[model samples]
Target: ITVSNIHIKSDLAIGEEVMDSLAPFIVLKGQDINTLEGLSLRQLEEGIFFMVSPNLKKFSRLRSLDLQDCNIYLQEGKTRSRTIGRAIMVRTLSCFENLVRLDLSFNYLLGCLGEILDALKLPLEFLSLRNCDLNEDDLECLANSKHALSLQELNLSKICQFSIYDNDRISSNNLFKIVFCFKNVKLLNLAQNHFQDSSIPSFCEKLPQNLKKLQYLDIAGNVLTEDSTLQICKALAKVKTFQWFRLTCSNNLLDEALGHLNQAHENAVQAKQRICGLLSALGRTDIHIEIVKLSYAIFVDLMDVMEL
Candidate 1:
């Protein structure tokens, strides 16, 4: 069975027949592809309806599984009492030993990172568990996974579990678990969380230096301050491989520190120009100009104090 561009409803009996047909490729849009067997299933917006039966090993040939935007529900009336989708149960995932990429993002998943970690058996290169209700244990489990060691991009953003008044229990700077768990991650996104200034320095000091391959870092929508910003800059400067740094404190107080930072940058530039002129006089104008350009770019891109 080589069907393309198909739609499946909640009818389970018909879906079972299609799964047993030994199809090589199956595409289900707005339908649950959970019934299809012996094919590479591509599920688009069908994540909400996915319900893994205990006997999921029938699809032994499934290589690529995409379940984006699935809704996962916790036990009824547990936390938010809403339909949330998380990674399928560990028992169901154990059946797919050939999977390469598993995208379980934009779901209503709760704390089930351990189950997800146990289910990953293949050489997965990309995994997205974004917006899931993750905690310290979840971070630890992922960091310890053998499959995760080879991952190039990992997105674990928006994993908060605190109401406005519950800030005291949730430390804004909960970076220890993350830094230790994803020590080898190349791209990390920690946007829209409860990070604070006091918690920033510890994160900066303990960040994995082995993350030299790290290219992108996003810590936006938190409560970072000038002191925290300086610590971050210092930490970033130590990592020679970092290319893009995005720090978002949109609603925080970062205005007063801007003038001081600007003045420091200007002084550094003036000193560099004097040294570059000396080098140019010694017939090394090309090297001097390249260094100057790099420095200027860093100065321009560093954090600018935003008015409250």
Candidate 2:
């Protein structure tokens, strides 16, 4: 059957036998099933198992699959299941070789990142696993994935369980390795994680020139400092393909470093005007309008003072 502009949102449950009878001979041809637009399946009650069916492979034209805020049990009873179970679930989905986008964010899935990476050696272009209880080992597995070379966008934001604390003892080298793995990534998001200023220099040093194809980079809500921001700016300047960027250092100490970015002609015009407007509204008339001429310098000064 052919349907157009349809939206499906339900909480019904069906067993395997029922699913077999109701399975679509051909899934619809709208954005979720056919077009390049991404899918969103958030806060699902039955978890991803609801979407899984013996006949799922029939949808040969499927492209994107999004399963955000899904629930996956890490243990059964008092004992934990072997990693194989998790691997099987992911592998089942990866069988869809045509799938280009996959998002499994906020799933509380624990362990077996290796299995997930192994299954992902397909032609996926976008992947997101934000706040999925991932650790350093998981990050390493993703970085080293053979399929990662084909990935265009990756998001690992708010996965604080991976943070390196004195108790957790995750090494800096492992973190750097993960960052380096995205050398060819076109868009990357690592916001609200544990990255700090100390890790900036190493990260910049190892950043791959192959990232010239990268267009978007989001490093917001981290512990970035002025020095770290400066290092990031310098590193990004070498990338010729970057067109969009977001650095959400709301409460960080990188004002000076971010200010220096105003010197870049690309950022000077709009950024300088925005800052000047804010200052004028605050009745800081003493802050001469001429300060806008030295856009980068003003940026650095404002950053030092945390004014902009």
Candidate 3:
């Protein structure tokens, strides 16, 4: 199942039987093929994008699919506004009737989300489109998709990084588009999206009311100003639910590449504690902040910046 770096042929066409037979053995990353509940297609040529598993008739119950960095994008002649949706990859994904977790990270899906959502039969509970070269309009499509009301977890981490050539970064307005759209999201990860403290202070004021059901928020890796960080602290105080939600923020500085990570974590902890202490002194002791580390799905173990 570890089919990486294979240059798919131009005339490649998989029949129903071959696709079904390959489906069961398609769920493996590194050495764990024992749990055959998902399929991960990664590190392949562009031709592999459309020819991998388009006809998995026998694999109807497959619930998870990971197509990370396979250079995914819509084919030529396909426009976003047109409803002529027969994209090969989208059609392939429609085969999964019970898929709840879908990770299409590290590719180029600029304006293809609409067709993918149209092909899906059920509402996805967990969706990770991290670093897929998505634009504002693509986010708009996902926001208005059929799964918007039912989607619980969304990982848009690193989408602003774009792939190498796409120089455009996701702005704060685009960030709030997700907030204003996915109202029922419980876990939201916007880590490493290049936030420069332009409009976050004002947006933090509305964060509580926007994502009322948010339980775990990973805002780590974006270097916001100290005042912006404090603004987030004040915003969390007005969550109304008084329920505990895990929060993580970037260490906001780095002396070297991954070298000052521990210090960053320590510094973040101290900064948050100082902010919360100030709030407590002003009779805002209704909230509690603690530090803990946990692994987000597929990402590295981020030192939990703080907890509440």
Which wins on TM-score, candidate 2 or candidate 3?
A: 3
lDDT of every predicted structure (CA atoms): 0.51, 0.56, 0.62
Best by lDDT: 3
Tens digit of lDDT per residue, candidate 1, span 1-308?
A: 44323322222236557553222222232223454433223222233244343334555445555544434443323343222333335556777877766766655444466567676788566677755655555566676777556776776555664745453222445544555455566777665556767677667776636566666776655555545655665566556556665554323333424446575457446644654455445454433121122222223313221210
The residue-by-residue lDDT of candidate 3 on 33-68, one tens digit each, is 233456666554555555545434345666777776
Q: Residue 231 CA error for candidate 2 (Å)?
A: 2.0
TM-score of each: 0.58, 0.65, 0.70
- TM-score leader: 3
Task: Report the lDDT of model 2 for residue 57.
Answer: 46
Where model 2 places Cα greater than 4 Å from the true spot, the runs are 1-39, 47-52, 74-88, 162-173, 208-210, 252-308
Residues 31-95, candidate 2: write the lDDT tens digits. 34443333344444554444443444444455676666546544212334555456456656766
RMSD per prediction, one decimal?
A: 10.8, 11.0, 8.4
> What number of clashing residue pairs does each candidate have, in the order they appear?
11, 4, 0
User: Which pairs of residues clash in candidate 2, taking residues 3 or more apart in a chain or in different chains?
Assistant: 226-254, 255-303, 259-299, 259-300
